[model samples]
Target: MNDTTPDSLIPYDEIVQEALRAVVGRVLGQVEDAGGVLPGAHHFYITFKTGAPGVSVPPELRARFPDEMTIVLQNKFWDLAVREEDFTVSLSFNQMPSKLVIPFSAITAFVDPAVDFGLQFQAVEEDEDDLASAENDSANGASERDVASRITSSEDGSNVVSVDFGKKK
Candidate 1:
């Protein structure tokens, strides 16, 4: 047998990413079905690319975030509508209400701290030439800090699923 391993013809990385995104969709759909009320002690911290295609955020918010931003869906959010490709929800930032349209493809991380469950996705690069220096910890408000800390504090790696497909040389 040959010593070197050959790359597969199938696009396994994309396929896996698509299927994993569907999990986020299904979870959001369940919340929508329940009249937008999160179950007891269940909330979400979702991080996504602010500049990604099909993502809609207020001009000011985008200006502040510029690259990646996280949002919390808990007691104050409303208008939770989940569709096949994306989800739209209204959230308050600095007491200013705004609606966000985020495609599942843009989501980088999703965490539910109540159950210690999280999922991290690889961001789709729109322009390789555009290098952003902002950190992914940026969020709209103070509460997101808690979520971010919790995610990074995990030492045992319990329920978080992170997929990284390395490039073939």
Candidate 2:
């Protein structure tokens, strides 16, 4: 008997990533619908590429997080709005308020450390490279303090999850 497997015509990785991001949207939407009271230990830590398209972060924030950033969506967050392709929220840092709008495609990881639940998605093509380039560019253009502040070591070393939808006949 010979083994035969067909190549995938559909982009399963992208599709799964989209669905996973919708989970983020739906979860945030639920919190927004419920007036920002997160249901029992259900806070999120969302990490995304800073330079990805559709990421609307302030210039100061972009300067501070030139490559990737992880945001905690816990008790302090406010004004969350979820749309079809993206979501926006208000968070505070150093007693200063900042608003961030992130598209689903830009998200790389979502974790609820309280329950030890996490989801990691593959970064969109070119976006990953762009993030690396952005970090290099920032390091060259900005002060040492600025570059140092933006560095985050990935404790979870696993890269994005890739899914294949191809099947064997």
Best prediction by lDDT: 1
Candidate 1, 156: how far from true, in Å? 2.1
Tens digits of per-residue lDDT, candidate 1, 1-169, equal: 8665578699888899999999999999999999998999998888888889999999999988887888888889999999999999999888899999999999977888888888877787645643332244434454544656655546766587877778655
TM-score of 1: 0.86
Total backbone collisions, model 1: 0
Q: lDDT of all the models against the reference?
A: 0.81, 0.68
At residue 90, give the lDDT of candidate 1.
96
Give the per-residue lDDT digits (tens) of candidate 2, residues 1-169: 7688656787776677778788878888888899988888776767778888899988988888877777778778889988998899898866789899999888776656555556666665444344332132221134333322233323545222334343655
Question: What TM-score would candidate 2 get against the native?
Answer: 0.72
Off by over 4 Å in 1: 1-3, 126-140, 143-145, 152-154
Note the residue pairs that clash in candidate 1. none
Question: Which residues of candidate 2, in runs, are more than 4 Å off?
Answer: 1-6, 126-169
